[model samples]
Target: MAPTSETLTAERILEATEEVLRRHGPAKATVVDVARALGVSHGSVYRHFRTKAALREAVTKRWLDRTSEALSGIVAEDRDPEGRLRDWLRTLFEAKRRKAGDDPELFATYTVLTDENGTAVGEHLADLTAQLTRIVRAGAEAGSFETTDPEATARAVFHATGRFHDPCHAREWERPGVEEEFTAVVDLLVRGLRGR
Candidate 1:
């Protein structure tokens, strides 16, 4: 328990909210629970977040931002664009797999939250596709890819690899030969992009 004298911050409230959500899930979690976890009043929590909906939405955005931040590093790396694309896809797949396998309860909680907060989910998808667009544009600019529209190519790439990153397909990620299947698909996409 945190000391009552500790100043309540949005980050602290968010961290507590995540733990509360992880323990109780989105349907059952409450702002009061988060406040209790943080040793603060629910009013203090509300001071940072205007309402329960706002708190949940902010937490969902925070969760999604973590993946975007992770992938942004790969997008910014100065390396062979093709290799960067491959690594980027692999990193995404691995990140999803870890989230599903490592903390399935939290993952399930988030799935529900994502459904409730469609705007946040949509924004997250757009951000991810934007990162992919940068990578594809770099590849095309470097003459490693043949694409008239990098944004379209990025969308295609993202959709093509959805099986690996989409939460709906999480169960299959642990299936036998999933990595081989992912590699084959990535190879085929890379080959297609290379104008082979």
Candidate 2:
């Protein structure tokens, strides 16, 4: 069925772009491929996204937003900040692990897209750090943590746990004892934050 203009929304374009990227990888995927997939004109896709770069960036942002949105819930929970932080970290690690393990080709395509869209990648890092800052600040406020610089602490925690969440380390995620190592690191981080 041909998609009418009424149904040709930006979301649809992005969805089609994702499929194109999955099929073609970032190197070969193009705005034309996206339009072809939708049975629409490339101009129609361009009407929604001003440029090919813009479209790619939007799809990259969309992909990263899924992780941010999932972690946002843990940030909002009114529970022990320590537990919340742990859950938040674990959630992020699991999310990354799943993405890398579940659909590796799509994951690799996104890795390329993310590299090409530095602005979107930077924004994603900022958002993730901001979420971490909130969790750290809450922990400090609740007397569960002893950090005076929550933002810096959050960044440190993020970097320290990079192995579990960073895509570059995706291969190691499936290694034996990886989860145990992640838990050990999280325990050390929480204990360190508690001024132990």
Report lDDT per candidate: 0.93, 0.94
Model 1 ranges off by over 4 Å: 1-6
Evaluated against the true structure, the overall lDDT of model 1 is: 0.93
RMSD of 1: 1.7
User: TM per model?
Assistant: 0.96, 0.97
Point out the worst 10-residue segment of candidate 2 by lDDT. 1-10
What does candidate 2's lDDT look like per residue over 21-75, in tens digits?
9998899888999999999899999999999999999999999999999999999
**Best prediction by lDDT:** 2
Q: Model 1: which ten-residue window has the lowest total lDDT?
A: 1-10
